[model samples]
Target: MTKKLRNAPAYIFLTIFAVFSVFPLYFMMVSATNTSQEVLGSKLLPGTNLLENFNNLVAQQDLGSALYHSAVNAILTTVLSLIFCSFAGYGFEIYHSKGKDRLMAVLLLAMMIPFAATMIPLFQLFAQNGLINSTAAVILPTISTPFLILLFRQASRNFPHEILEAARLDGLSEIAIFARIYLPTMRATYAAAAVITFMAAWNNFLWPKVILVDSAYQTMPMLISNFSSGYVTDYGALMLAVLIASLPAMVIFLVLQRAFAEGITGAIK
Candidate 1:
């Protein structure tokens, strides 16, 4: 009884925080089912306009193509990033050397350079190569992020070198060792990386906006921008589109929440 009383304040604070965090999502969902006036009026109750809003969004926009482009960009980025970043991280930590440490420092320094400074050069290069408005253009710039590399490098510190050595002595190739041993051992870390990478790729806007010059290559973020860009925006359809756009990232994070927590804390298991 006494312990429960002592913990009451913490529980109360947590409950309040959770409500605050969740309220926006709830409001978004509610607004998706309401008209523009009701939404502006801040109606908290769910309305009957969900199907109408969805139909209007689909009829007015190429929602299917946007979803496809976003999914392709996000999945390819996440998979490629995991493979490359994990390899870089594994090599850096497992084969520790002075040269590698220096290189890692340089890479970290590169992170400090703002993307805005590099965007113009990147655009010029891509234009010279005639790769504008392609999925490759969108996916290329993001495949191996410094942050992901740093994340994997930090996680690799917890990997057991004994297993690596034993596998090598047993005549396992380096690739085989990584594939069979290190990969399996770092499942939680990989899940965390996937969640982060997928969310970033899915929500990426500025680069995609600059690179994907064609309307056919539009992503969900771009679609949302189009929906809200007009002088007379349909708030119901806009909210519905936002709800749909938000679902993928939300589902991925919720599914991987536990692994994400564990991985962030460097829990080996």
Candidate 2:
């Protein structure tokens, strides 16, 4: 009874914070269900115009194509990032060559440099390669992020060395050991990386906006930007689009949330 009383305040605080966090999303859904005029009127209750709002959004914007582009960017970037980042992380952890530590320190420092500084150079390189206004351009540069590499490296340190030595003694090649052993053991870390990479790629705006010149190649963030830039904005349509755009990220988070927690704990443990 005494312990429950002591913990009551913390639970109350958490409950309040959770409500505060969820209210905006709840209001967004309510606004999405209303007409533009109704949304502007500041009504808190849900209305019955969701279908109409969505239809208007579809009719006005190239939303379908934008969704396709976003999907491709997110999925491709996530998969490729996981592969290369994990490989680099594993190699850095296991190999330990001379000067490799210095190189890694430099890479970590590179992550601190603002991405805006590198944009012009990246654009020039992509343009030279005829990748301007292409989905490949969006996906290529994000394949090896420093942060994900760090995550994998931390997780790799916890990997069982006894198992690795056993595999080596059994005539397993390094690549085979990595594929059959390390990858499976780090499933939680990989799932966490997948969620993070997908969200970053999906919500990426500034780089995609600068690189993708053609409206046909625009992603969901670009579409939302177009909607909000107009003089007379359609709040209902905008809200609906936001709700739809957020769903994939939410779904990914929900699916991998448990693994994400496990991954973090496993790395630090």
Candidate 3:
């Protein structure tokens, strides 16, 4: 009884924190079901306007194309990032040469340079190549990040070298060993990377906005931005759009959260 009493304050604090953390999401959902006026009035409960908001959103925006574009860009970026970064990471750790270490240091240094600093040059290069407004332009800059490479490299440190030797002795090619052994062994790491890469790619707005000049290639973020852009913004429909846009990343994280935790903690197996 005494111990329970001692922990009561802590529990109360935690409950309050949890409520505060969840309230934004709850408000977003509730606002989605409200009229624009009601949403502006900060109505906290679900209302009867969800269907109306959906109708308005559909009428006003090209939701389908936005969803398709965002999905393709994010999925491609995540897939390519995983493949390229994982290979780079595996090589860096397994090979372990002084030259590679210096190269890695250079890559790590590159991460310090903000994306904003490089956007103009990237835009110019893409323009010169006639690649502006293309999916390739949207995806190319993000498919291999220093951060992802570092993540995979760190994860690779936990992989067993003896397994590699055994696989090699068994006449497996390097690619075969990576495909058959290292990949399965690092499932958690991959899950974590996939979640991270997918979320980043999905939420990316600035680069895509700059690169995809054509409105037809608008992504979900751009669509959401357009919703909130005008003199007469439909707050309810805007909330609904945001709610929909947020779903994929949330789902990916929830599904991989356990593995994400394990991978972040460098847990092998």
lDDT of each: 0.93, 0.93, 0.95
lDDT of 3 by residue, 218-237 (tens): 99999999889999999999
Q: Check candidate 3 and list the clashing pairs.
A: none
TM, every model? 0.97, 0.97, 0.98
What are the per-residue Cα lDDT tens digits for candidate 2 across 108-142?
99999999999999999999999998888999989
Question: Which number leads on lDDT?
Answer: 3
Off by over 4 Å in 3: 267-269
At residue 78, candidate 2 shows an lDDT of 95
Model 2 residue 188 CA deviation (Å) reads: 0.5
Best by the TM-score measure? 3
Q: Which ten residues in a row have the lowest lDDT in candidate 2?
A: 94-103
Q: How many clashes in each candidate?
A: 0, 0, 0
The regions of model 2 sitting more than 4 angstroms off are none
TM-score of 1: 0.97
